[model samples]
Target: MIEYHSLREASPEQTIAWMEVLAENLRPSDLDEIAATSDMDPLLSLTTSVMLSDMAWVITSNDIPVAVFGCAPAGPAGSGLVWMMGTPLMDERRTAISIARSTVPYLRQMHQRYACLWNHIDARNEKSMKWLRWSGFRLLEAVPDYGREGRLFFIFARYDPDV
Candidate 1:
């Protein structure tokens, strides 16, 4: 079974361990964008989520982390940026799918306050793009020279106009 937990439910050390795993396993195509987005330190990104996210969840299966996702306010009136880190889905397909399924409801709940929640996906990360589309986000635009290292990225979003 997949379980969701608050950051307080797991020690900071445990979360950092997950972040380390995510960092070590990032695909070469994703590495530069992730570093640019997260300020070059994956641990800092997770730690920031723990501190600033209005909504966050760590998804685990059989006591092992499958993924962690968080949403934090971004300017532009009730908009937020959504972020996620996970173990390689290819290695844990079932667990990753379970986590992906759970993320939709969590995201819907965030829609209560966030008019739009978006993620910047590396243009070369086709796997992530596929998953994001399946999870209900629209591919809004392709941004050229979007990152610190001049990589391209796509902006994907789920928007609630009523917010």
Candidate 2:
């Protein structure tokens, strides 16, 4: 069974332990993005992201963490930067399907507090881009030199009209 838990329920050590394994199996695009954007190693990057997020959740399958995702305050008021990182276990068809179905509703809930949810996705991450489009996020311009390593990236966003 898959279970979702608030990050608050997870201890720092537990989060780190899960992240250490997840980092090793992170999607290639995620590994590349991290390499381009920060000096931190995969474990550090994943841990830091969790720590900075205002609201986050851990997805566990049968007690083993499979993913961590959440949103952080962006520069403007009512704007947030959304992000997700998961282990290869999430690639299982059943798990992927379930998470995909839940995504839109999760974003809608986030929209209650954030008028705009945005993030930069590595251009090579076609799977993520497709998922974002399916989730109703608009894919804006692509930046040729986006990160410290000067790789390509696309800006993606979803806006709440009611806000």
Return the top candidate by lDDT: 2
For residues 39-141, write the lDDT of model 1, one tens digit per residue: 6566565567657887777777776665677898986888998877665643367765776677788888889989899978888777777778888889999
Reference-based lDDT, residue 83, model 2: 91
Per-residue accuracy of model 2 over 72-154 as CA lDDT, tens digit each: 88868999999988877777888877778876767887888899999999988877787788888998888888888998888
RMSD of each candidate? Answer: 2.5, 1.5
Q: What is the overall TM-score of model 1 with all chains considered together?
A: 0.83
The number of residue pairs in model 2 that clash at the backbone is 0
lDDT of every predicted structure (CA atoms): 0.74, 0.83
Identify the candidate with maximal TM-score: 2
Worst-scoring 10-residue span by lDDT in model 1: 24-33
How many steric overlaps are in each model, in order? 0, 0
